[model samples]
Target: MRIAHTCANCGHDLSRLCALIDPVYGLPIVVCPRCREAVVRTSIPVRTRARQARRLVVSLAMLAFSVLLTTGFAGAVIGLSSVVFEQWVRAQRNSAAPWTHEGFVVAAAVWAGLALTAGVWTGAMLAHWRWWLVLPAWVAMLFGLIFFVEVQQVVEFIAQGEEIDVLALATGVVQGHSGTSRVLIASLVPFGLGYAVGLPIGAFTRRSAARRMWRRRRRIRLHRRNA
Candidate 1:
């Protein structure tokens, strides 16, 4: 399916114009025969540009919503798992049992799973974007949240009249003092990996579905013609 090109000024169909270099501008343009308006090769109609802008805004909104939703879900799962693990530990207090980091492992797994799911959903929803671009943006958004938290901590420390060590602050952020920070750091790789894997899957699935529908429509048209 292709969009029909028309003159921006006079709305004359310019689809059939012979590609020519405009003498005045020395640029490739299609001269609309009816209005004699030269539509530059690089010029997009206002309507098409507006539509693209709307799509971009929608894609960003969807991406943000997905991230927030995933973050909340992951937090809830980790909190519940932690509570359950604490209860189990109390129950086993009578016996001489070794302490296990099972709760941390479970939380990490939950974060990774949620991140992967979010990546897949985002890739599918914004399949028009290049995977390379999408992956970096997605990872940056995750890390950006962590950075914001770190900055807040730094500000709090300053407010308390504590001397700040840049190296220590950086190390702490990297080591993750908070659960949210840890989850974001741990899921960084998984989120990017999932998005890289999902892009091709999503694109292929969308294309195949479109192709099938096109074939079906063609077949129906042929049947009608025969009838």
Candidate 2:
């Protein structure tokens, strides 16, 4: 005895007629050949683009949230550590600086590491974004945050009624652009290195999830076959 399949859209019986069946990728779908052709022609490409755009938006949002969250956490940790270390250093010697410039550099590097790692992982898990995409998103997030902070400061200067020096402003803008470019490269390079390790870890996790789902579906099919 053959199992009957029904059309997904029109609910027409398709078991004895020309039908298209697709069960591998997502939900099992049975439809008339005409409907399948129409879907191929119109809905599929539109849905694909829409899905990609949605995922990209979600990834960017997650990246932003993770940067804010992890940066706050790192800042809190650094603040506490600084206080404790400062006390210890002060007790040890009267001449030692509380936080050295070298120490500040090290702390900044650590914070960057934390921020990038947290952002990439959270965004990938939530958005199902490709691993390669995360690096670009990370770079964009850094530039965006930096731009926003600088732009806000510029606006505040204007609000304070400071005399605007057009030449000075132009020079600052040119210099700022140069500095931002350097910062972007410095930040993105280290973050991209992390991506090498992180990408595989995320891929393995997603692949394992897919395997489990496939196994479950296979079992269901076997059970139905027996029934």
Candidate 3:
């Protein structure tokens, strides 16, 4: 019905106990698993600092990879976007149709937000991060790609000053829509696929690092004992 326990580290007395069975360790901490601190069961804040840290590192790495891969593989599109889209935005801002310019700016902002969100989501998903985080990340990645690849194409066309070749550019992207839609769709596949692909890589990397950390810690602990 009841068990006696104390903080493994601090040895604080706990009046009540929880019913948790860590078959490996075989104990519940009055020292809460939350804060990894000794508590009287008052408010053991569930500190996910370690998880969050791992997720953060993975998020950053994924973001880098996502951007690099997307940019590298789709250099033309990305480059065109940088050169074409921004210019269009500026032009729109100055033009009589200023609202169009605002749209362009809004579109760019959306893309940026999506890229970041995607990076973070893919990262966390791979890290086996919480559900609350996973969905948002996926959305961000998808949206980011839509804006980055598609909208960029749109700007390029506006800048080209050439007669629009409906067939030349509209390969896989814009089926019903125009050339830009095609570009967006092209990127969207990988952008979504990235989450799936990025997950395994992220998980693998995180696991590898954690394993190394565990080994190093064990070695040090052993060394201290021998000494």
Residue 182 in candidate 2, Cα distance off native in Å: 1.7
Model 1 per-residue lDDT tens digits across residues 115-222:
777677666656788767876666466556556767998999899999999997777776653544444455557666777777778899889978987975664454
Each prediction's TM-score versus the true structure: 0.40, 0.40, 0.29
- What is the C-alpha local distance difference test score of each model? 0.63, 0.54, 0.51
TM-score of 3: 0.29
Give the Å error, residue 10, model 2. 45
Worst 10 residues of 3 by lDDT: 39-48
- Indicate the residue-level lDDT of 75 in model 3: 43
Instruction: State the lDDT of candidate 2 residue by residue for 1-227, as single tens digits.
Output: 12235544665555454322334533333446656521211124565588779979997997788767755533433343343444434544755453554554465556457646655554445346665776676556555555565668877898998767767865675475563345444555545555565666777788897898797576446534433
For model 1 the TM-score comes to: 0.40
- The residue ranges of model 2 lying beyond 4 angstroms of the native Cα positions read 1-104, 115-132, 149-181, 219-227
Candidates 2 and 3 compared: the better one by TM-score is 2
lDDT of 3 by residue, 1-227 (tens): 11234554555444444433344544332445544774322222244356568879998997898667644434433333343355454766677453456655565555444444444445544567654565454444434554566657777877987556556545534343333433334444444544555667777888888998897576445434433
Estimate candidate 1's RMSD in Å.
12.2
lDDT of 2 at 88: 39
| Residue runs of model 3 more than 4 Å from their true location after superposition | 1-126, 138-189
Instruction: List ranges where model 1 is wrong by over 4 Å.
Output: 1-105, 125-141, 160-162, 175-193, 204-227
